[model samples]
Target: MNPGASQEPAQPTPGKHARHPKAGSISQPLLFAASTYALGQVANFLFQLRLLYLLGPSQYGETGLAHLLLVTLIFLADLGYSSLFLRESGNSPDWQHTWRYALGHRLAATTVLLAASALGWQLWGSEGASQEYLLWAAPACLLALFNYSSPMIAEGRRLAGLLVTQVAWPAALLFWYLLQDSLAQSMAATAGLSVSLGYLVQALVNVFCSRQLKLWLPLVGKGQIGAAVHLSLIGICGTLHDRLTPFLLAPLAPTFLPFFLILNHVLSGLSGIQAQLARLLLPTANTAPGQARILTVASLLLWGTATVLLAGLLIKDLALFTGQRPWLGLAAIVIFAWGISASSGVLATLLISARLEGRLMRLLVIGMTDSALLQIGAAWAGDAGYLLWARMAGVLAILVWQLKLLKLRFGLAGLTTLALSLLACVADATDWAMTIGTVLLLPILIGLLRQAPCYLPARRAGAHP
Candidate 1:
């Protein structure tokens, strides 16, 4: 018998108690998944607030930098192998065999990431880079390395596990914060260690939950490794764009780094909203072409408007809370630019479901190239202000090119969303403007929220209303 085939279970005899394994047998209901996800988000948001309060801006920035680097390096190192494993796990007759194979890849990638992080820090680290950061960050990175590639098919339970993971960091940090005087440790060090402990907890929970997951499992054949690599290459631009911006900004404008990091976190929350919307709606959109367009435009309208309001309010509140009011204007500018870029992401998801990958790829490449060119030009000129503006211009260029490539024409709702997103740039110009924007947006948002439930089922039933 083949080595990989050996992991396949023997057929059960035909009897009253005979049972067969099914893919996703352990998966939980959608309601449970949604509830867990919301809980995780709330936990994470509170943690960020606590983090800002506990660690002063400087220390918070340092910890954030290290955390981002670890995350980016791990994702880059994984090279889409985890994603490939996820797809294969649902289809393979012997997923345990596939799991072992993916585990081997994951281990290799983790090793590479650790080495790269160490070498990069040694060469380029700031003088303030502390031993405590590394002491904690290393284990945290390793613990999180194999998380997304878990062999568990239990999405709902997995989400609950993740909520535990999310809560763990904040809960640990709060404990450390309270004990700082007794422990004789700096806030930065404790914060780092707390998050590390959180990762450790997550890894432990994952192991316990996934009983089939074991280090000793024998590795199987190289199943679709090439395809994984190909997917990674295709997505490399997005990963770099997402992760490397902070690195670039840090060297040029050290003072702005912390604020930028805060904004990035806020944007991540926004991305989560978009991801959930896409996940919930894309399936229905794929079923009916006419409804897809209607649903797509409506999603963009609701999402875009909500983002503008949320971005403005959150940035304003965060600035006041953190005593970093100077950064509010910059936040608005970033939000305005990214609002357009984000619309493209929403549309891309809907369009991809319609089988337009080739056009999407072409448009993405062009947009990225244009953005890079603008960034380089601005950097070369040594004008930080211009560099920021150039970045926004690049984002606008991307939105334009993407729409052209996808041949998307906006109806009244879509055009209104674009206009509102555009006007969001001025939200930070004055306190009154922000307040007015909020007031005007409240009813639209309320209406959208009320109509949201109807959209999923009604749209799926071929009624746009």
Candidate 2:
């Protein structure tokens, strides 16, 4: 372990969140992680843009769908062992042993998922040799799964694994796409193969950096399995919340799927900001003990809400320029859902860090049940607008429950941010002039700015009540 790293997890009291590490201690890793992740996402975006140009909208949507399915499958295969490892083994002296044990179960699970995917492809796939592509996608997903928690477990002490995982895979994937002269098979199949090769390259580089490539071990204790499975239940529920929109849209309104996919792709890039923030804060949670101050919680929500509003407005203009005007209402709903999810996710991370995973998972299960019911009703209604609205309502339901658990409230800063977000959504959904939206939001924006001093260093002193 790196010098001064904690040798045991911090045990905060029940019903409280983790304390923040000193800003200076976390600043370097936060900067390094943010910059590298941004670069990697840029490469990924360029790769997607190139693919869309090469294959056109309809085929691009298929490729995106295939990618989403493969990603979800990988998460399902994970079964939460890696998450359990991050939560438990972060301060273990024999961390490598714990990693190997978790990895062994992950490999076993991956094998089963791969077999199931192959069987489903053979039975349902329309294109020839698509199963071959599926095989390629598996290794890529496996490598990604292995590397997912490396940075977190390292606790920002060594970022070499993170640099390799974030920058190398996407850059190599883009490079491979550039080298391909033409697609010998369908675009989706070719993309699967190319992406898999890129992951292989990533794994090779990571192994060289770490000086080991060991995977599984005979460490299948019942306690380990049960704990990991419990965590995986939470993961699967979160997955349902995120991927459900596309899943429901694909079959019910095939024609609208591409537009939603396009929006998804763009919005996902913006969501990375929140993902990285969670990652940066997670290490603090593992190492420190105390409840988060109100200022910190409020700032987190405000920042997340502001990001979604900005991203929504920007995407709205992009849609108009691309002549996708009719889909702006759909965009509004998607953006609104993202804002709620983003805020809720930060709180969820805090709860999980506090060893409240079981509680969080139960809430997620309840939320998913509600969402599934709403989605089914929307599908029966046979209107795409209603389907999206139903999904957003479901997301809002989750956020409301989370607030109750955390005992957070919409203070002035939060309320202003919320108003601005809603205003942006209304403008897009109603086809109001962009200037009208901006002018209306200015007062709320000014109020949010005035309240920003509450987040400054001076405001964070004393214990969180």
Candidate 3:
């Protein structure tokens, strides 16, 4: 008998589970996931704060550029295999084969990435701080094997292990920052070491917890490479848009790079919570589109409102954190961008679960291209604020494109949300504008609150009716 085959009772069909492995309500896991994700974000925020203060502007910018390159390479190495694994593992009996194949492919890809990095470094030679940072950071690519793979494994099992694995790296960084203040080692080296340690911890925990699953990696698995490649291509444009933007901007506007990096990080972190929640809600989207739609819309409204409120509350703290004056317009833009991202994420998940990857690929390509062109034009203008607004336009385009693909007709509520966000942008630009915008937002917020309970899990028939 194959070692990967289990003797225990057969698992229920993937989408057939009446209730999520957690409590019946999908909100439970989402809440837990969000909590863990938020904790991780906190740790990450601290780590970035420390690093920025330690390295100062020029060195921090270089580190940020290196970090971006490493992340891009790692994402390329994973090649969307993890997402494919998560989606397929639930239903496929031969999931072990799938895992093995993906693992093999990932290993090969990582090898190629390392080689490419080394080759580029050798050919281009060292340029400056960024190149020096890359030299130290390149070794961390080895950690990507665990970095990319472990989360997927946890996610595939629909376990909280993802939270654990996700938080490990930031925790490691915080630990390092507290214990070691020595400038003896390069900042990049310290960061790489911390991240590598974190990934190792994550890998170990994931493997141990998933032991009962009897996971195995064969030398190669039939058809796995081709399938992963196909899925990966669907994500390429979006990935490039995200990872390449920093690289493009670093050279074009070096002084703004550090601030842009911080702004981007904060915005992405804020948006990440929504993205994670959207991911948690994805299984439901597959099994119950109606419930998922309600939840998605509700989440968008709740978070959108929260974003505006929180930005207002934290404006001072944000300025202090970045050591710069807070730009209300930029803050508003970030909020709107996240709203678009959160909504698009849920919609994208639904489409992906529906096996509409081809459509998604086309949408991504067009949206990313449009966004890139706008960003380039913005960069040429040499204003960081304009660059951010350009990004907002891109996110909005993608959101609109996603709506079209999902065939979700924009309702009055949806139109209101968009209008309010745009108005918030105007408000951010002027003090008087904000006061008027706040008055307009009152009714929208009240209406959303009134509709919130309807999106919650319904009470049992006898219990409620």
The lDDT values for all models are 0.55, 0.61, 0.60
TM-score of decoy 3 = 0.78
Worst 10 residues of 1 by lDDT: 9-18
Give the CA lDDT, 0 to 100, for residue 324 in model 1.
Answer: 59
Q: In model 2, which runs have C-alpha deviations exceeding 4 angstroms? A: 1-31, 87-94, 121-135, 148-155, 182-187, 213-219, 286-322, 431-435, 444-464
| Model 1 lDDT tens row, 67-137 | 67765665666665543443343445766665567666666777887887778777865434344555555
Candidate 3 off by > 4 Å:
1-26, 90-93, 117-133, 147-157, 178-183, 212-218, 251-256, 289-323, 451-465
Best lDDT goes to which candidate? 2
> Which candidate's TM-score is highest?
2
Question: How well does each candidate superpose onto the true structure, as a TM-score?
Answer: 0.72, 0.80, 0.78
lDDT score at residue 312, model 3, on the 0-100 scale: 58
Please give the distance, in angstroms, between residue 306's alpha carbon in candidate 1 and its true position after superposition.
Answer: 6.2
Worst 10 residues of 2 by lDDT: 451-460
> What are the candidates' C-alpha RMSDs?
9.8, 5.8, 7.7
